[model samples]
Target: MAVSNVPKYHIAMFPWFAMGHMTPLLHLANEIAKRGHTITYFMPRKAQLKLQHLNLYPDLITFHTITIPHIDGLPPGTEIATEIPISLCPLLVETSDLTQDQIELAFRANKPNFVVHDNAHWMPRLAKQLGIKSICYDVVSAATLALVFVPGRNFPKDRPITEEDLSQLPPGYPSSKVVFRGHEIRPLMMITMPMGKNITFYERMVKAKKDSDAIAIRTCEELEGKLCEYMVAQYKKPVLFTGPVLSAEDMKTPLEDRWDKWLGGLNPGSVVYCSFGSEFILEKDQFEELVFGFEVTGLPFLIALKTPRGCATIEEALPEGFEERVKGRGVVYGGWVQQPLILKHPSVGCFVSHCGASSMWESLMSDCQIVLVPQLIDQVLNTRQLAEELEVAVEVKREENGWFTKESLSNAIKSVMDSDSEVGVKVKNNHAKWKEILGKPEFMSGYADRFVQNLHDLVK
Candidate 1:
């Protein structure tokens, strides 16, 4: 078809008000705009500012900021997930839901050909009333969606979701291999917890998914086809995939000299780099165990983390005389470090990650030997996909109480770091093989093309 013959789309997106949700949606927006479609992205004032730098095709992707209404529990002016503690997120959700009228007004004015959203269960029905096709986008791991949070997962009678229940698999679940352990069920178990006066988290998710015109996920069909297919079967809806949708700007950006000069001085493939995502603030005990675990490895290490609870800083949380003992070889900083560039460093041979969906893809595409220490439910299932299904990473074993000791964490890292160990060599080669395939431009771009096509199909 000629340029004039192509049907140009104007799409509206209203992602959940979290950094994790917003970032991937922006990446998808970039992909859509690259193909000459127009996007009207709706977000809170603070969030729109944060994502401004990432909007590669500014001419095509226009942002429309909406006011976050005041809620009693939410601090004044709290607009996004980063501004408040995780416990206060439900309040944030309530605050954001107050913007539905503003959003509906924009939809009526812009008259976008389609709309995309997640979490906000009311979005699909609103899209219908406004005559816009709605797509429920899953930006997390496909395995996480398929295994744990499948709609209609049963509980005995009207009882609450427990760790014991989570240990058991839901019927027709695609993969039994992605099972959750006792300690790893908290994130999932929270689904039954109320997110609103009238709605539970699981109910919100089921409504968003079931009511949407189509289900879209940030994954490659090649990588997670079975899981994506399982979603189609479970929801009885068309499931479209968007590959990893990693930021192009991130790949183009260089590692800062602060890290580059330091990491360069070390031997190749000798350092252990560990980082959980920004949201998880550890308990002081667990924080110390993590630092000690890296310390006992005797390898150079970098740990980027938020200050643990009850401690003012990482320094205060350290074990006695710990800084002096490992002075030159280790550093624990509470600031943000560029993970993708850090993983690409020559000295960084192993990655101990929490396996958040974005981090999971970054680790897979890097040369580092993968080691997982999953805390949340999504991270746990992502770990299983990499460790069990893909055989590309090693997961640290937690105790019966759902906590890991320094010894267990140390052993998990060493198993994949030591060349003589069978597990080390196995994961190394597997990681490299996966890296080659996922790193290819064609493989990543193909999914984006198909995703946009699906959008066209739905609207037509």
Candidate 2:
């Protein structure tokens, strides 16, 4: 742990072109940089802009931008996956692959000691050709990784995963009997590449695992101990847990921000903060149901929704008179907000979230109890961890056919926020316990040091 004793490495970082993926890599990069390792963070030009607000080490970390190649059917200016529809993600992957040459040139110039990459499946091969160590970094829950790597899943290459397939526990997974419903699996199946390519998402994941020197995941042993053990045994490789990587700065509220001013006026733990991450574009009906659900709760709330592409305004997408009816108690913003600051606010009691890993960690690091309403890939799996395994959240009830109604959403919110309810009290207590653990600087710093030490061993 001594600064002089620790080896200083030149590490290259490449993350999948998504905010969820990039943000965690940034956290890891900062952690590594603090250890005196030099880092070359590679990302698309537009994607690099997202990190401008953060305070990163100037001497130890450098940003290397790659020009995204043009691909047909993809929007001209789209550089990240969240900027486009989920259906166009395969095109994004293809276009990103075209940048391999530029990345190679940079790698050759710098000659990094090792490379850390997310689901950009081809990275391992490129690292091998360059004679450097390759580390596969996952930004999702261990259960999702376990399920994806389960023997015989045949994910994207086979016929679409059926309801029956999801209902059964994946073979060879450790004692946890996690089962997915059809609705949960549907979005994952939708993210496939063109058929003839011979490389499905499942294959890509397998290839990354097979080719990497080791794996690093964005979770703690305390959170997913069993799945973490299983991943190591199944892959027969060194698996390092990087803990939650939750920043202490997230606890600070920005001065004079509009949302901060509004939150300041409310009573402590009296507001509900609702947000479905950037990637999930809600259908009109789904959006209406959620709005009605929030209305029924009759609690002070703030909802941040991204306007889908081609949608001119949030008002056009929302129900008529929705804002007027809840004028004093509720506010809706069309685009992004400082989510972590809002989560840490004293007035926020509950977070109705999409269960994205980033949001889950942020909520866990805050005082707010979680109400799960997962929308896309791996989110449902994360919901299982929060609602079932950890007992720190309440999942909205859906019909047998997997349809959730406004009534269900309202009830779910109340079940977590209602002071008189036993479930509500337990969920809040569990969230508090987790927040205490994740907020400890020593705990997070230890994990980050272990992660770097493991990378050092891999390269040696």
Find the candidate with the highest TM-score and give its number: 1
Taken over the whole model, the C-alpha lDDT of each candidate is 0.86, 0.81
Model 2 earns a TM-score of 0.95
Q: Where is model 1 poorest over a 10-residue stretch in terms of lDDT?
A: 181-190
lDDT string, candidate 2, 124-183, tens digits = 899999898999999988888887654356443457666565556665676463546536
Clashing pairs in 1: none
> For model 2, where is the 10-residue window of minimal lDDT?
190-199
Model 1 clash tally? 0
RMSD to true structure for each model, in Å: 1.8, 2.0
